[model samples]
Target: MRMVKVEASVSLRRDLDTGTEMQRDAVDNIITQVIEQGDHALYTLTKTLDGAELDQLRVTEAEMEAAYAQMDEELIGALREAMTNIRDFHQRQLRQSWLTTKEDGTILGQQITALDSVGVYVPGGKAAYPSSIMMNVIPAQVAGVKRIVMVSPPQADGSLPAGVLVTASELGVEEIYKVGGAQAVAALAYGTESITPVDKITGPGNIYVALAKRAVFGKVDIDMIAGPSEIVVLADETGDPGYIAADLLSQAEHDERASAVLVTTSNELAEQVSVEVEKQLALLPRKDIAAASIRDYGVIYVARDIAEAIHVVNELAPEHLELLTKEPMNLVGKIRHAGAIFVGSYSSEPVGDYFAGPNHVLPTNGTARFSSPLNVDDFIKKSSIIAYSKEALEANGSKISALARLEGLEAHARAIDIRLEGNK
Candidate 1:
């Protein structure tokens, strides 16, 4: 890790990968095929890309049973407990349809409605992330979404990993599809014969899937164009070098582009952490990936004080921030930007990623400056409600007409005037 004095500002914002020209063209072609050929395109693409010759597009009851059979009772119990924690956390974020009436009988409020359907794309083929299945699905369920469909690529043997299947089954998500990549995104956006179109799509995938989500955005809502993982540790002299090093590596091993930065006030602590990171990096199975990430994107900034460290952290607006200082809670309100803030030593990043009730699908690559972690709100839409009584309209109608005419909208002005005249 490179150590430097804290500057006026620090940033590690990487431009989101928009894919190459060839990749964009390929994604465009895949979406067109799925739109035109429907299930046939899905079947053909699965065989070509995934090498899985699936007879059908949906997972069967037998497959679900087998997935459960492969899992032991202990793991299943842990998943359930994690699900409860997640549901409880998001349930607090749920909002009810509300209205307020004025003295003149003008009713104004907002109506919150869950999406009719949502499609969660869990990445598969190489690894299975049961935790992702929980994070993405639980929020939508809390928002009262009626239909939730899950899509993932199958293995060469045409079977999803037991973990993926068992997790989705545990969540009561029955509409699982055996598909992945850009084609799966297309099928979710524009329904195939077997799969119904969803109102929104949420999850992370490869570049092709990201490009597909970008293409089908207007047609259906998407969570975000997520980038690689990022972690920023703001620590002081009291911070433990070993804990900080382990936390940094947890995110570094995620991707070669993943960033792990440390902004600290103590030069001694910074030196210790640098050595600790190098020592821990050698022990990781994904040493090559982590080493590359540390080599290219990792850094340690020596700040003048805790205040300077906090300022640099806000400027970075990292995806995952850990305040490993002596007084972590005291600095919570000072942080203005961060997708998720892990306070204190015990509150590590993985705690939030796996079990600690918050959604791990957070904004990355400095998007935390404006965006938020995935939650119930992403699964629902809000509609403004306005009910104007006869008296209320008569009182405000002339002002409304004048404002409309000021914009040179004759039709808008007339609509209000005509209504007022009729009421009179």
Candidate 2:
């Protein structure tokens, strides 16, 4: 890891992936094919892209039973426990419909309602991310969203992973489909014979999936375009070098583009952590990937003082921030940006990723500056309520007309005038 002096300005904001021309053209072609050919395009694309010849798109009851059988008792118990924690956490975020009555007989409020349907795109490849299934699906379920669909690419044998299947089944996600990539996104955006269109699509995918989501934005709502994982550990002289190094490596192993940074007030601790990171990097199973990440994007910034370190952290606005300082709690209120803050040496990054109750799908690539984590709010919509009484309108009609006419909107002014005249 490279060591650098904290400058007046510092940042780790990577440019979002705006797919290459070829990729965008390919995604456009895929979307057009799905819209024109419907289920036929899904079948053909699944064979070409995933090399799987499938007779059925939907997972059957027998498949679900088999998925459950393949899982061990211990793993099932762990998943159930995680589910309970996640459900409980999101239940607190649920909003209620509220209205207020004014003295002039006017009712104004906001109505909270769940989306009619939602589609969750679970990526399929080298690993099965059952945790993602829980993070994305549980919130929608908690938000009272009906008809949640799950889609993922199938294996060469035309079978989805047992862990993925079991996780979806455990979450009560009945509408499971074996389709992925831009085609699956298209099917969710525009209905096919087999899969109905959903009101919104939420999940992470490859570049193609990201572009597909971009293309279908106005047609249906989507979660933000996520970037690579990032972590920043802010520590002082009292911080443990080994614990900080271990936490940094946890994020570095994620991908070659992932960033892990340490900003500390102690120059001694920075050097020690740099050494520890190199020592531990050799023992990791994904040593090549982690090595490349640490070589390219990892860094340790030596700040002049604790205040300078916090200022640098805010400027970076990392996706995951860990405070390993002596007074970690006191500094939390000063942190203006960061997707999630892990306090002390014990709260490692992975703790939030898998077992922790909070949703792991957080804002990345410096988006934490303005964005937020995935929650129940993403799966629901809010509508403003207004019931104008005769008294309320009579009292304010001329002012409304004057304001409308000020904007050169005669029809708006006339609408108010007509109501006032009829009442008079």
Task: Give the TM-score (vs. native) of candidate 2.
Answer: 0.98
By summed lDDT, which 10 consecutive residues of candidate 1 come out lowest? 6-15
After superposition, the stretches of candidate 2 with alpha carbons farther than 4 Å from their true spots are: none
**Best-matching candidate per lDDT:** 1
| Tens digit of per-residue lDDT, candidate 2, span 119-145 | 999999667999999999999999999
Q: What is the TM-score of each candidate against the true structure?
A: 0.98, 0.98
lDDT of each residue in 1-424, candidate 1, tens digit only: 9888865445688888999999999999999999999999999999999999999889999999998889999999998999999999999999899999999999999999999999999999889999999999999999999899999999999999999999998899999999999999999999999999999999999999999999999999999999999999999999999999999999999999999999999999999999999999999999999999999889999999888888899989999999998879999999999999999999999999999899999998888889999999999899999999999889999999999999999999999999988976
